[model samples]
Every structure is written in structure tokens, then in C-alpha cells.
Target: MQRPKPAVIDRATALRYMGAAGWQPDAAATALLDKAEALVLDAATPRAALRLLPRSALPTEGQGNDLRRHLEGCSHLLLMAATLGGELDKLLRRLELSDIALATAADAMASVLLEQVCDALEAEQRTYFLQQRGLYLTGRYAPGYGDCPLALNDELCLAIDTVRGCGLAVTEQHLLSPRKSTTAILGAADHPVTGYRAGCATCHLQKKCAYRKRGITCADS
Candidate 1:
């Protein structure tokens, strides 16, 4: 839904991406990010969709107790998918042969750019859900985020008509094709919800997460 012309790649986010590789990027990482961001914007085709479902339909098995508790208050689910298409993958492949370091930096910049696209998509959907359905949205929760089962990746295909609707597919390994795409479920409620923590802190993977290592929370990331 949002290809955000030239992704507003910030220094902090680039550093966080480098931190994922167990390193850090300089303030000038944007110099490199500019190149990748340009390639992504030029090649990427952004698209998204919103599907509403009853809370009972979400998967429960293949998850830990904390995740069960995390979903307790929700009455409905919102299935959303967004993709930057597959063009960037081709450029990334070429970049891989040209320079590994540049490829790594590009990968990091692409990840942050994908997040920005998702953020913009979510913001638009959040406003629409609140205005039209009178529902407050819990932040977007993706499969493999926290203890949610990676198995749900396939299920989303059915629930959201993923391939036909959004040009996304999940491999047997559970990775989304196009690499830059994302699928998430957000909590929908009739009124303001409480007693729920949000962002990366609420994630089961937060302890070992590189983003958290640098003091970044999920919502901010």
C-alpha cells in the first residue's frame, strides 16, 4: 500500500540493522542506504489488504503460555498483508555478486524500508478500523513474532487470499517470498483495551533480539 517513494532510512535504524549482524553502522550509513533505498523504490511494487476475522479462528497450538495470555483480551482479528513485490530481489541478487558488504548493507536498509512501508499501511488501516468499525487495534503481530506459530504463515494464505490478493507466498521453510513482504494480525476491540503491554517488550523473542539489545522497542522499530 505504501512504497514511500524513497524510504526515509534513518541512521538509528541502519545501526540496528547492522547490529543484527553483530556490528554497527556509522552515521553516514545513510550514504549507502540511499543507493539501496533508491533501487527498492524504483523496483518495488507495494500492495496491501485488510481482512477481518473472528478471534476464535486464530491458531492456538504450537505456541507458549505467554502467547495464549497475550491474545486473551482480543475479540476479533485483523489480517493484513503488504508486499514490495519481487523486483528488489533481483537487484539484491545482482548486488550480492558485485559486493558482499554492500549487499549486507543493502539487506539491512531494505529491512528497515519494509518496516516503514508496513508502518504506513498499518497507520492507514488503524484509522479506518477505528472510524468505520469503532475498534481499537492492537499493534500488528506477525507469524513468527513472539510464540505465534510459523505454521500460521500458510493459514494466512487462505484467510487473506494472499497469493491472488497480495502476490505473497510462504515457502515450506515458512519464509515469505519477495522477502520484503509481511503479514500480520492485529487485535480488534469494541473499546479501549487494557492490561496489555505492546511493542518488542511483549514479544517472546525480545530477550535474544538484536533490536532490543540496542534499546529499541518493537513499536519504535
Candidate 2:
């Protein structure tokens, strides 16, 4: 079932995503943001899927205990995919400096907007599962986190019918094309939500991360 679309984008949240991507914007960056936001409106489209997947579908071995621990109490998996349409890539096809920066900023904004949309969708699911049916949610665990190989993306995209559902595909390298899209797994828990907080350790930028010094979390984006 579909939920209400999220409200207009939040500048702070978009900045947070840019911060996670390691681009501290100056005035020029902020200016890029306006154009980027317009591009998001014109060029991006969000897609997602929700299902009560059996835990067996998730690889419980390897990938460290962090992911397994997170899903320990859950009975099902929640798979979702959201993407900015291919228009952004078309916008980036030109090999020019100006286009490069615009493509980069717009890509960052797409990440934030996609997450914002999914967060809203996740919240709606949590409300229904918790208040109406008594369940909780684990934070989303995308492939490439910890020891979970990116190759698993193939399995996930296939399971969720991402190509048909959202025009998403996983390359042989396990990368999702259109570059600004993501697929993730969340667990359906039986107790109150706990033990998951966005932190430097779990972030994609944890390697030589500046945010770690400032006590920031990548997932905040």
C-alpha cells in the first residue's frame, strides 16, 4: 500500500547528506544546491518496496555479528529500493567541469531525498506494525555494510523485482546503476526499537573520516 509522500525537502537534511558525502559546501556549494534542488524536482523519482521476508533470505553467516545481532529478534526482512530517475545521468553525460559539479551536488541531494522518502515510509510501517500489530523495526542494512558483500545486491534486487518494480538493476560489479539509487534490508522486531544509533563506525566514510572527530553519524543523512 502507498503512504503519503513526504513534505518538501529539508535544507538541513540535504546538507547533512552532503556532509556525509564529504563535501563541505561554501557559497558556491549552496548556489549549486538551488540548481541541484530544481534538478531533483525535474530529474529524480523515488521507488521503494516493503515485504515480510523470511529471515532465511538474509545471509546470517559472515558479515560480522552487527547485522545478525540487529536482526536477531526479528521475524521478517524489509526490503526497499529508491532511486532518482535516469535523467540525472543524462544530465551528466557531458564531460565538463560545470556539469561535473552539478551532477555531484544533484546526486547528493538525491541521496538525501530518497532517504527522507524511505524514512517516512519506514515510519508508517513501524506505526502499523507496532501500534496496530505490536512489532518494531531494525535500522536498514544495505549491502556493502560490514562483511555483507555487494554481490548480495543481485539476490536482493532479484527478490524484490527491482527491475520491474523500479527500473533498478545490479551490475556484475554489484553496483546499482543510475548511481543515485539504493536497496536495503530492515528487520521487523517484536520489542520496542533499540540498539541502533547512527554512528561513525557504521558509516561509509568511516575511513579517515572527519565527521568522526566531530561525533557525527553518516546515517543522519
Clashes of each: 1, 0
lDDT for position 123 in model 1? 85
Q: What does candidate 2's lDDT look like per residue over 1-221, in tens digits?
A: 22233445666767665554455668887787888877676656666665667778866557555666666777777777766657756655542346877776676666677777777877777788778867787877787775456787888888888887777888989999777778888887677655344345554557876556666544442
Per-candidate local distance difference test: 0.72, 0.69
lDDT of 1 by residue, 1-221 (tens): 33454435654676566764434546576467667667656777777767889887766545654445555677888888887788878878889999787688777767776777788877877899899989888876677775566778888767888888878888998889888888887777887653244445446687787666667665565
Best candidate per lDDT, number?
1
Number of clashes found in candidate 2: 0
Query: Against the correct fold, how does model 2 do in TM-score?
Result: 0.79
- Model 2 score (lDDT): 0.69
